[model samples]
Target: MLEVSAAREIVLRHAKRLKADFTALMSSSLGQVIAADVASDVDSPPFDKSLMDGYAVRAADVSPTAELTVVEEIPAGKMPTKTVGPGEAVRLFTGAPIPPGADAVVMREKTDSPSADRVVIREVPTAGQFILRQATEMKVGETVIPAGTVLTPATFGLLASVGKTTVPAYPQPKVAVVATGDELVEPNRRPKPGQIRNSNGPMLTAQVALAGGLPRYIGIATDREDVLRSYIAEGLEIANVLILAGGVSAGDFDLVPKVLKDCGVTAHFHHVKMKPGKPLLFGTKGDKLVFGLPGNPVSSFVGFELFVKPALRVMGGHIDPPTATQKLTLSEPFAANNNRPTYHPAKRDGDGVRGLKWFGSPDLRAMLDADAFLVLPPGEVNYAAGAVVEVLPINRTAS
Candidate 1:
């Protein structure tokens, strides 16, 4: 029975950052953490340009009822050809380069086109009007996107604006799921007496993929030391994380601890003082993370959210891990007191969270309609209605 803080500390101390490579284009880099700071190679909008489709002219030439001769027309993408001289103007389009010696631009709507060669200005335009200065968006050699920034679509557009084609990011972590149970058969296979088709395997596999990790299904292992050790050894060779299911409890046939001990794996914490997932095990074999979850389907899912998701983020070089803890009012009273911290699958309705009624750990039926969990800490009589309590969302939007 370990405190929550103590358990977190143990997991952090025992965890190791993953060693892998990842590089992709900025468009494909969404949700990935940047490994290096993104610097602008050149000034954004590189040169002084016009921000409006108008006439580029010297500010001195602009006056009420003054007429200036149009010397040249400049469109976007091509450089300006003529310099704006006294009593001279250039027709410019949006994004066109400002011609030399031009200090202001008058909107076309403001000026009357008396003739094709000459234009009369009814309004006086001020200096620097409709001009976008160079390097206004970003400066050259300045860091635009810093390291550890989780790239989104907006960030990707920013990177592209700064002329970054490819991006450097930490590779997605490779997770190997080892579901150890003698009574568990494969999901596609039919189950016999005293056998249950493995639900944790497919569930955890999908969970890993959702967490931005590559999931490798290593199949099930019998509750025997030799078979479990062989599977673990194989997992250690290629996976950054080895997730073991159904062999962490203090049951007679739990062989995960013995196998890890024999393989010289370091155990951070064997048990956490949390209901539905008390027997969670966090360990490491060199740089690989080893997470052992309980046998129950519901407990396995909860353990992945509580432990494995954050661990994967840290290993993937993300500065901030996924978090879902938020304060919400409880719609019903909770009965689990001081014995352990309880995380009951719940649904959020309006402004409050309602914990569902179900048989404790092994019950997976209540979770189908559950959106999150109404978390209750130790040493509490009950959470009365209208009390603010922390809730951890288990839905996809939480991360």
Candidate 2:
């Protein structure tokens, strides 16, 4: 069996990066990756603007108890018409451009308007105070955002600030999810005595979507060789990444690996040295990647986090994807399982991690309330309640 890190390296080495495509800067592009660098056409704030609603005055013009004449009133979005000369000030609102020859601003609370045109300044003003200088955020021709950046709401706003109505982004990978088992039935149907509802299909589809990939469900295939072969072929034809759950383990009905080989996929690795997902299979056919995950829910989730998530991120043009490990202290004692590296579902409780009530790999309920997976490396016997350990946060995407 391959180690977890080795398996990840093998998978990523075989996964090819997808081509870039231009997309409109819309709500749908929030999680997409940027393909090229975006530069600003104009300086942010464009001019010397006021950060507060105050009077723009020259520092040398204001005395300890001097009353300066208000030359002009500048509201937001409007330019100042008059300059502040000696013993003069401009009444400006927040975000308004500062008048020429003004170097400082005094808050309205510090001064009283004895009359509409005349204002009494109570405090001496300092130069360059309360002013957002031109190009303070970004200068013209400066790269506001670089390639491989994940498009968040703030990223979109930055693009809009640079006048980018249409963004150049990497295309989301189309992922085909296939669940194979004779005892699996659709979620809407009542399962027979010997059958169970297919949870892996929906779970994988949701994972794919959450990782910024377009998921296509290719339905379930029975244990029959021909049936599984047909479904695998369809998935390969429709998706850049084909994920098959079940039929990869060394069972009598295990046929996905052979079927994938027949469909021209070259096997990269077969088994991983991790609990719940040791029977993982990774392969590639041409430019398309393939993964055969274990049938158990927890196994599938772990496999996706360890291998598939990084591959998807790389394909989508992310420069440095997130690693599935974080340093966290355990809130309670944890007994290590044999010698295999175990990823057990746990909750992040007030700066520490606590194990959830898990009933092995098939217990989907155990992970429902879990925010992370506590990683126990091999050879660990037992860790005390306060022992520090590595954790993998669940359902979190890399920025």
Scored by lDDT, the top model is 2
lDDT string for model 2 (1-399, tens) is 898988898888877778888899887777898889999999998999998898999998888778989999999989888879998999999999999999999998899999999999989988998999999999999998988888888898898889998878888889999999999999999999999999999999999988878899999999998899899999999999999999899989999999899889999999999987999999998899999999998899989889988899888877775455789999998886646888889999999998888988899899889989988777755889999989988874433
Model 2: per-residue Cα lDDT at residue 134: 98
RMSD, candidate 2, Å: 1.7
TM-score of 1: 0.86
Residue 389's lDDT in candidate 1: 84
Residue pairs in collision within model 2:
none
Ten contiguous residues with the weakest lDDT in model 2: 316-325
lDDT of each: 0.83, 0.89
